[model samples]
Target: MGLEFLDVFEQWANSYDESVGGQNREYKAVFAGYEQILEAVTERSMGHVMEFGVGTGNLTKKLLDKGLNVTGIEPSVPMRGIAEAKLGSKEIILDGDFLHFPDIINVNTIVSTYAFHHLTDKEKNEAIAKYGKLLSKGGRIVFADTMFESVEDYTNAIVKAREEGFHNLAKDLETEYYTTIPILRTILERSGFTVGFKRCNDFVWLMEGEKQ
Candidate 1:
């Protein structure tokens, strides 16, 4: 059978929280920068907030703490369970996939953290179209995840993994979906979003667009 993003993630369910989902305290501290980006997005946002792939609510507390009305879409049952458990009775935790949600929510803006990169190119493009179609006029989307900086990073990672006998770690590091900046920007543009910014580390991006 063909591989799916959810499939691989499901297999990594146990490690999902500790690895990159920001469940651990150290991970959360390291991810503080991304949280700042999400906060800025929330502050500038004019309407509702929707998260397409909210894994374990790493950013959930930050968003909810702001008292912003936010909803999230997650496909992994285990991950969803963790998130729902943390966000009890909030009613915003919906068990669904971003590209195949049964209901449509037209909001002012949408944001996600570290989740979009898991999707395949086809699903990513489809999601842009599907979600963009649901954006209210003047709405926007802002998200940040791994954006590839160099092919050498992939090569070096693989090489290091082989030397260290850490195949699983290497495989997980392969999620540099937005290999180049322009490619992702082009896709978003075609889907009616003007590229705001795409940044990493101390860098930050605020690519957004009005529903046209």
Candidate 2:
């Protein structure tokens, strides 16, 4: 059995800003960590930096501020509009899911936050494989997201969510596509990217890869 649950990620498109899930000090810290990775890896700016699921331009604004030429792709129409307004980069951004793309073009470095878990397990694997092929050699890929060690871990997340004033609808997601450190490593390895992960805390982790 694979993942059958659908939270229909679009549900959060408009209301995300109001939700506690969207506003947090930890989230800002996570974004800063990604920026640190970007600064460390990106020695020379070549081609375009792309971020899948660029919601509301949180990280997008930071990257843009750093003078990085970025192209953002997003699935939710409302979210894409929000990102466009927030990012103010009309020409470089596109609105569509990564699956629809024939290939993710001009990607020298890819950064995604809280977006990878939105895909089904199979799709996640396939997307990683495609990402490997599309990226320029020696390109770095950075990601930050919430993941758990097990089902019990998700239960704990639910309790944490209760404190945050939302429900952990992702509890039924058992494929580890949503939360497995081991799977994160294996998928990237099989996809032809070198895998690395850093634990931010009990709830989140940063996964990085090199297109090799």
TM-score of each: 0.76, 0.75
Q: Check candidate 2 and list the clashing pairs.
A: none
lDDT score of residue 54 within candidate 1: 73
**On residues 1-212, what C-alpha lDDT tens digit does candidate 1 reach at each position?**
01257776576567755655456443343254665666665665555778777777766666777777787877777777778887774478777775666574557677776666666667677888876788866787777665544556546655775576665545656643534455567778888876766554522345555566
**Model 1 misplaced regions, further than 4 Å:** 1-3, 7-34, 37-41, 149-167, 175-178, 202-212
Candidate 2 lDDT, 151-189, residue by residue in tens: 577667666645654433334233335657777778888
Off-target runs (Cα >4 Å) in candidate 2 are: 1-10, 18-47, 102-104, 150-152, 155-177
Give RMSD to native, each candidate.
4.1, 4.7
Which candidate leads in TM-score? 1
- Total backbone collisions, model 2: 0
Cα error of candidate 1 at position 85, Å:
1.8
lDDT against true structure, model 2 = 0.64
